[model samples]
Target: MTRHPGTNRTAQCVVCGRAFPLPKLRKIGQLRPGLHEMIAAEVADCGAESLICDEDLAHYRRRYVEKLLAEERGELSELDRQVLDSFEKGVSTVQSSAASVLDRNPTFGERTADRVASFGGSWTFILFFMGVLFAWMALNVSGLFAVPFDPYPFILLNLVLSCLAALQAPVIMMSQRRQEEKDRRRAENDYMINLRAELEIRQLHEKIDHQMAHQWERLAELQQIQIDLLERRGDTQRG
Candidate 1:
């Protein structure tokens, strides 16, 4: 209700008791009843004429969201905390890219594993290895050299294949583990985005409802004023 001594352009915030431009302040009467009650619970002396700055209103809005989340979920996860923090900070919860969640500087071993996994799963690797196997068997069985290095049964080739399988299995597994981590991070990012959107929608509904209620109150006041004016005119005529 209070303003700066020399200017009517500013109003005092009930919560902070600081003067702010009227455009930056909101009257308590215009707020949704639930939010108004929340403010009243905290600020005992605040009334319909009290004004709250945008910053204070946003703080209360955050608290209201937190309360709603707590009532529904009982306990908040790290993801929820992250979403709430970003909401309060007025920042987007989205990542720049899906891969942005991955470590920027992967270790040499991890990089090598990923490369090996990528190549091993490709059709080129399968066809190239098939040709190599055919050539090795043909050279050994057809006596192409004086004494084939791999001989008839190709024991050396078997050993080579065994070692490749052993090494490739672990490398592919490492790569898969990294991929699983990336998927988990992507899921978390999605969850945060959805939660923020839901909260924003809820806030929008609250604002719309409050606006409609305020309009109704204004219409009612106008009707009452018209009735009083008509009563006064009738009385004056009778007199």
Candidate 2:
């Protein structure tokens, strides 16, 4: 059982098969992912793995856990949502829609990388650079229909092109850097989604095991009761 340090609301976190919230603890839950950005700069002064695990998993199971996590991480699509809604037979239905999202949830980095890559190799970038090069080369070179607006390999033109490239390259690099940052953030969201899913999955497994254990315990208890009843009957008969 994973206990929440310095607390009483023992984690019934059936996911990792741990009980928690014992004492001397703090909980960092009841928060939305939108609020997570502000948290990026907040540092935990001194804490061990157990406390980290407790807080991380607690938020994983709070209200709207699956939906909020999936939506924020860009894992849930409209199509998925439609299918999920249809699965419900009533206005109030079981949480089976995402019952397995966490169980089958993928790693954040992996999923986000796949999505970003799907945008197709920043080819717009390559095309833009190529267009600039071709235009520069053509305007200054003698060729079809062009006596060369600036004459073959114009020195002044080349210098101008060089200057433009120098300026443009840095801007392009800056744009690329910003793009990379976006990818990194998306990847982080995916990771958190994956983490929450894995934790929830572990809890589900724990729930199953707990139920099975209790079933066996209850069987034993009932058997004892039956035996006692039979012995009492026999004693009365003998009496």
Candidate 3:
């Protein structure tokens, strides 16, 4: 509901670059350089970057940073050292917070069972088998409504049915095997995402541990220096 650049403006997602008609989760977005300036310049006498939606911000960030930028650094004013330092600190803090969240987070993979289920359902498969059986029975039975389409006892009908099943079974099996392969691929992608997340978490903890160890080492060094200085002063006074 709240607006940013204009009275009725919707913010584009900094992460995904898609615009929202209504305000979205603000924490997910960041201001890309020149985004506002280009929006202001839109449809002028010259070319300008078009406004985008929040849903697309990530894609834009990945694909169109250069095209949108009017200059090498993306047509933005040079950031002062203080601004840069503050930005870096903010980023580090956000990353640390994300790491903390990820450490405690549980990840469950998106289910690939839907694809497997799509191969066919048990009900449908059974229905198909029932249809085949009913057709065979009707053709063999001599009745007023029945035609001799399959003839008496339906020997030829059974032979044809057997041949059809023999052919179709292998194809259905192939389809199922292909589905299994796709499921394996999906599982692998899930594994990779999980692996990357774990690595990122591990790296964060290692960094924090290293910083703590470094601080301890520095404290120890300072204590040793103080002791040395005190001993030197005492020796001079004694002499």
Clashes of 2: 20
lDDT of 1 at 106: 86
Best by TM-score: 1
TM-score of decoy 1 = 0.87
lDDT of 2 by residue, 151-199 (tens): 6546766888699778656555654664575666555445445554554
Q: Return the lDDT, model 2, position 149.
A: 60
For candidate 2, the lDDT comes to 0.50
State the lDDT of candidate 1 residue by residue for 1-239, as single tens digits: 45655656777899999988888998887888888899999996799988999889888877878888999999889888778877877888884344465747888998998999999999999999999999999999897799889897889999999999998999999999998989888888889999999988988899998889888989999999999999999999999
Please tell me which model should have the higher lDDT, number 2 or number 3: 2
lDDT of each: 0.87, 0.50, 0.48
* TM-score of candidate 2 versus the correct structure, residues matched by position: 0.41
Clashes of each: 0, 20, 13
Could you tell me the C-alpha RMSD of candidate 3 in Å? Answer: 17.0
TM-score against truth, every candidate: 0.87, 0.41, 0.39
Q: How well is each residue in 50-139 modelled by candidate 3, as lDDT tens digits?
A: 334544433333223334223444553322222223232332212322334334533331123333344445787678878988867775
Candidate ranking (TM-score, best to worst): 1, 2, 3
